[model samples]
Target: MASPIHQRLREDVLASVFAPDEPLTEAKLTERYGASRTPVREALQRLEQDGLVERRGKAVVVRTHSAEEIIDIYESRIILEQAAAAKAAVKATALDRQLLTGLLTQMQQLDPSDGRSLAETNRAFHAQLWRATHSPSLIGLLERLDQQVRRYTLTTLTYPGRWPVVLADYAELLAAIGDGDSARAGEVAARHMSDALDIRLKMYAEDPRTL
Candidate 1:
């Protein structure tokens, strides 16, 4: 059976409801999830291994990335994603294109008001891009970066005027990849990743606590 306690805690961290550096004692988490200590400890240990939490003095706290660290992450993400896009252009099969097309269609048809669904779809779309790379090492690195990047994710669509920009970014990037232009794919991917950083930074500027 799935560990509902673990899943709930994981979701809270990913959602940013659990603030960085916030203390998480076993008692607190156990109470929060309505579970016993054993499961709570296991969940926290898993989170620690995942780099989302760390065991501190007497308790575990949500891991916080400094602004510089986040910048470095974005820098790494740009490199990996750009390379993935280029490689994908050379390797993506007909079925991959069809899957990407389906994802794009889903995004287009997604309700503008549903931020959660938009976020999930966005994750799926990008994950699909990485899969097209056909490189296990690249995919693994990209997945790690993606997970870390998500820890700081703000709802882009929730920000005024961000939704359209994001939609345009993906559309252009997808087109470049579809055309099998490695250079163009790299360019588009770089631009898209930069745009994403800009959006996150803009939100962080407005509310320093968001990050």
Candidate 2:
């Protein structure tokens, strides 16, 4: 099992619980996680390896992003999701469609006030879409990229009128895949990412914390 110390640190970093580029002194981390230097070092090492934090002299800093990095990340997601959706369209079986439909149902049940649950449902929905492709390499790459973009992507539900739009996109993407319309599936996927990027860029512009 992974160390609880590591897990907690990793989650906080990925979620941007600390302000971007905030220094995480070893002493502070030890005190925060209530651990000795040894375990804290190990946990910090893990987070560093995952690119969520970086070592600066003796202190660790949460990875920060600029607007350029945000754009770059979205561009990468746009390309990958297009491919994933197209493949899913060609490859998805009835079971895959059924499972994705069930996820859509869960999304409907999610309360708009609850950001975390809504984000998970959104993530789960995308994960299922990628799974239909049955490409382990693609899934692995996307999983990592998702983490890199998580702090931004998870905010898709924060804006008023956003959830319905997101659900509509998902519905369209799912329908395209269900009908084996690879071209339409890819187009819907690209459009969905583009729409999300619009919201993401807005969030980044409105708050430095989001960028």
Candidate 3:
């Protein structure tokens, strides 16, 4: 489990409270988080390991990914998500399936234009899917990839005409998992990541600032 200071800093960074490339000094962080110097320093170290922060010229700052790096992250996510979905189809227990169903229902009820709510629910749904796989190694890898992607702070679901497609994808993915259809689950998960990548690249091309 992450310490409170580390979790607080991680959440702020992922939420873009600290902008990309913003410098994070130990002294300032200690004051901001009401933490002692030791915990503040340790939290920064953990964030660095998580790839959310990095050292440059002896200063720690939020990590910023190049376009190429973003693409690479998504590509890795595609493979891992595909395998996770397939494994989850075989391994998901009754409780895991119940949790997934509940999250999907929450997502479906969200207004299409409410991007923030939709994104939050979508994240929970995916996290549940990862858990359903019952593989620690795979879950750890996916969590790291997720941490890097969340630092981007933009959802592909916010793209024009994307929300409905995402809903449909989730519905199909749920159905496949519920029916124990590993092949279909894997295919849907892979396609979902591919679609997200396509939208993300398009966004970057149109306006680099949007990302």
Winning candidate number (lDDT): 3
Record all residue pairs in model 3 with backbone atoms less than 3 Å apart, i.e. clashing.
Answer: none
Kindly list the per-residue Cα lDDT of model 2 for residues 49-109, writing each as its tens digit. 7777877777789876678987888899899999999999998888999999999989987
Which tens-of-lDDT digit does each residue in 96-166 have in candidate 3? 99999988888878888887887888889899999999999999999999999796645678889998898
Question: Predictions ranked by TM-score, top down?
Answer: 3, 2, 1
Runs of candidate 1 with Cα error greater than 4 angstroms are 1-4, 17-21, 31-39
Give the CA lDDT, 0 to 100, for residue 51 in model 2.
Answer: 72
Q: Determine the C-alpha RMSD for candidate 3 after optimal superposition of all C-alphas.
A: 1.3
Predicted candidate 1 versus true structure: per-residue lDDT over 1-211, tens digit per residue: 4488888998888777875678888888888889999999888888788777887888788888877788889999999989999998888988888898899888988887788888888889888998998899999998887777586674755678777777787778778878988889888888888877887788878887777
List of clashing residue pairs for candidate 1? none
Worst 10 residues of 2 by lDDT: 149-158
What are the TM-scores, per candidate, against the unseen true structure? 0.86, 0.88, 0.96
- C-alpha RMSD by candidate, in order: 2.4, 2.1, 1.3
Which TM-score value belongs to model 1? Answer: 0.86
Superior by TM-score: candidate 1 or candidate 2 = 2
